[model samples]
Target: MGCIASKPPIDFSADVNFEHFKLLRSVGRGAFGKVCIVLKRDTKKLYAMKYMNKEKCLQKRAIRNVFNERKILESLQHQFIVNLWFAFQDEEDLFFVVDLMLGGDLRYHAQRSGAFSEDRIRLYTAELMMALVYIHDRNIIHRDIKPDNILMDENGHVHLADFNVAASIRKGSLLYARAGTKPYMAPEILNKSGYNQSADWWSLGVCMYELLRGKHPFRGGTTEEMLEMIQSAPIKYPTTWSEPCISFLSGLLERDVTKRMTITSENVQEVLKHPFLASLDYDKLINKELVPSFVPDKDKVNCDAMYELEEMMLEDNPLHKKKQRLQKTTMSKQEQAKRETIGAELQRIAEKFTVYDRSKVKSTPDVALDTNIDDDEITSASPRPQRASGLAVFSNEHDSSHMSEDENALRGDSDSRRVRSQSTDPDPLELPTRLVTPVVDDGSSTSSPIQA
Candidate 1:
């Protein structure tokens, strides 16, 4: 009997790996990897695929750092933060599929919206405080808390991103690694003194100041100057800011870790104690019940399209061209031997790399829900909007080496370094920390991420 043929049943038990995702377009780049918009082939779910070339990672001695990031992310799950979904590796690249942030980063919005209103900033701070509480409770310290790390959902609620520089401190021992972006680094980290969770609040203060005022509270001409200023200089606040804000910033931006050491231990509300977030509902914030005042327009892809240009335009390998090149090339014996050596190294590394699938865990519900955008809504390419500026990349990391290499080595991302120095009059994205104007457009171009 000529019966209708049936399709084969799906094999959901298979491991989730690099082959499961279809690269959509390059969205951004890190020191050792490129972040691309990708879709899961089976479920058609969208995500940001952070892939690092095995050879480059090994050459740059960043293979361990990439693996550390994956491990740290796998153990963490929270709302108000970019959560990792799947981590896997291939012969060519190590891949991390994470939540896709389409609303752009805070720096992008600050360039457009200027200083967030006091009410808005209040909410933003409160939300992040909750996130920080969760992280600190777990003994993890997020060293880099700059505007670039604060991403927005389509709903405009801020979520903390980037854990490449995060370090876990033992119960009693303090973190001595000199990590974090210089502009937002806590003084304790800068001076090489041991620091704990307090350092994160200090960076939060820096962000608060930038959001409340358009400029950073500290500014300098060079790295040494910046370090000196951040260390020795007293932070000044504009009179326009409310007394509550002044108090908040003073507590957060305190140079003496002793001052903020206890108050900011587990949460931001301890010192203020219902004063700052007196009206807030902690439960609602955690569940994302309260809506943000500002919602990013969904029509626009809110990031500079440079990453896409680099991936598609510059012919950076790893698209269909990579397959084509490999297919066409006829390797000589020497080249084949070299390739075999690399393959062996990759195999050794791959054994240690664990594979994760989020769907396997049904006990944990969605902490932060996925985007509402349907599969068809993404189209062929996640087209970026024009004037989607938030282009900044850090140059170097301060390698104190006080702690283990795995703790501090992940801070430097060397994709490329382009420093744009402004004459100090605009949104204080990655600017000096000396009493900034509200983060708004003053008819001048914005500042780029600091390169220290």
Candidate 2:
């Protein structure tokens, strides 16, 4: 197998006809291509347009994958998932025009703040769970459900984005090839065994674990080691973790996919009745009533900081370039070696930081600056501030001194910064705070898990 380059060539001519859309700034860049912020000339609506190189895509044989993603997205309609406005292809590049998610992503937010409140986590998790149910109902499996792919709109509505790895499900059939972030993949996927929509539930469990813990449940040296951990019952809940939350996660992370949470399965009902989601109003969430925890005044990631991290990693680690798999292209031997090196290093960092007990921490940050705890109060900040629903370290005083060259070089940290920003800012659209209705626990329950 060829090692795909995780990083794309930085230099590319911008001669493609964008029609009436004017390019603003580059929002995201991956192995596949780059996503640029643009405004439609006529409608004046902002959009994030993804540009995929045709020649490169053909080399990777992802033409079908790209077309399938577009078809799947065009046919479905859901508030939780990101909206795909349109897809077009020139001779050299494929363009995907999607709704511009101003909040960036949950992964970026989490890294900047370290962690989020249980309440905020619950809000996002419930929203995503509902999305999974909807997508599965349509016979689509969103293989990738990590924070980066989960986006937030100006209205604070959560939208699941990035369906490049998504696939359709046939009636009573199982999927063969397994793909997704290794840490987020279920045991059945890692073992080369077949799976279906249940695989998404397992990834959801990993996402929930990451939301509260700020790290993956399983970290290992090799892919095999990570697989081993998932295959066993070594998932340890933090000492401060609530009983109900643990019960819910345990069911989702079950090794047996048949026993995992499914929309139509008893486990879904069991999860809904758990105390973790006890605050969610299922009707409101399903109806798009729940608002996102954070929104940004401006639609932009901290690219300067992120680019600095990438450069520092390239210089310090030498293996930084290959730390993450590039979905756009095939991997090369050198890149694969680098990926292994970085993945191992990242596992060490995850283990070290996983010690923070979320239950003991305050839901919001105790800042030295005078900021109101009320969700409606907006302080007189130069850039304009919003309600702080979760913890974010993006204070006015956050200078180069607060971050070390080595610390800023890490990849996951940059990713988590995106998530933290979602809950820290006021929406650009001046949206109202849509309250999340807590789940009504009927008092009917299931068996508990073995104490960790």
Query: Which candidate leads in TM-score?
Result: 1
Local distance difference test, candidate 2: 0.56
Each candidate: RMSD to true structure? 12.9, 20.1
Candidate 1, run of 10 with poorest lDDT: 385-394
| Model 2, span 253-315: residue lDDT tens | 898877776665335555676788877777777787766565543433422223323322332
lDDT for each candidate structure: 0.63, 0.56
Evaluate model 1: give its TM-score: 0.76
Give the runs in model 2 whose Cα sits over 4 Å from its true position. 1-17, 265-271, 291-305, 308-452
Tens-digit lDDT track for model 1 on 1-452?
A: 89998846446568986556555455565556767666676776678778788777655645545654665676678788898888877656777889988777777667656777778888788888877877777667788887778888878788998877676665666756566666778889878687888899999998888777776667676566667888999888888878877777787888888777344334454543656666677667778888788887675556553333454445456453554555665877986886776665566667767687766756433221221122232211212211101211112331221122232222212233111111222222342221111122234545443222
The TM-score between candidate 2 and the true structure equals 0.63
Q: How far is candidate 2 from the true structure (C-alpha RMSD, Å)?
A: 20.1
Give the lowest summed-lDDT range of ten residues in model 2.
Answer: 417-426
TM-score of each: 0.76, 0.63
